[model samples]
Target: MSPFAKLLLVYDGSAEAQAALERCAQLSLALSAQVDVISVVDAESANAHCAGLLSDLAFHRLEELARSTLDHAVRQLTGDGIVASGYVSFGRLNDVVLRHTQAFNPDLVVVGHRAQARRSRWWGSRSAHHELTERLGGTTIVTVTLPGT
Candidate 1:
């Protein structure tokens, strides 16, 4: 029941997300556990602009972008001798992450936390991680600490 066992990381195509993935990979190697990296497609947001008719081409594009992001992360992890898998799903970031969390039953959830000095966050919203922490009990939530404040 170590804290490092079974880690789940919420990934976006952001530098912070990459940092979180790296941290998760390090921990996965330390614990000899597999890390699941998830990237949300966010169909709901796209629906708002597309009149709920997100074109197949556009959807496919989204999927490709997500796969590229996750694949890169998986490669980094695997290259480092860490067990890893990637998943891309649709819906709100938190919802998709929670759904996968339920399925994976990870001992810990790793997410990139925004630094106040940073300009913007790409994970949709920062509060989602806070909400996740409140909703999930006994499951530890880790926020990747950036290099600087």
Candidate 2:
């Protein structure tokens, strides 16, 4: 078995994420890893923003979108000859990713680097790389960027 037998990849369907996915697909092939691609929806944000009457509906819609995105990612990876599966979950990205990391025990976690335009994320804007590094403990996190991005 390859050293990287279990690989976890985060995908948000953005162009940046697509670039990460492509690199992940290549790595999975070369390393013969089992890839788990997760698409996350921030339930905290959903509950905070979609309040009152439409909260439940908004949350449901967000969850459905997450599932759809995961499915598309899985299909793409499968077509790329990578053994992969898709998962959808709701929570803060860091928490959700860490939760899965604890469970999946992946050899490595791969993520796309966010653009500068998204530096104003909720909670004062931070890099996913930083969050994962802080919360993931011993897990290895790899950040991928599109060429010329």
Query: Which candidate number would show the highest TM-score if scored against the true structure?
Result: 2
lDDT of 2 by residue, 1-149 (tens): 77789889999998888988988988899899989999999978666675634466777888898888888889999998888988887789989899999888999999999655654764487777887899999888889987886
Please, what is the whole-model Cα lDDT of each candidate in the order they appear? 0.82, 0.86
Work out how many backbone clashes candidate 2 has: 0
TM-scores for all candidates? 0.83, 0.88
| Alpha-carbon runs more than 4 Å astray in model 2 | 50-54, 117-124
Please report the TM-score between candidate 1 and the true structure: 0.83
lDDT of 1 by residue, 36-90 (tens): 8888898778878899898889988988998998888888888998778889888
lDDT of 2: 0.86
Q: Which segments of candidate 1 are over 4 A away from where they belong?
A: 1-3, 49-53, 115-126
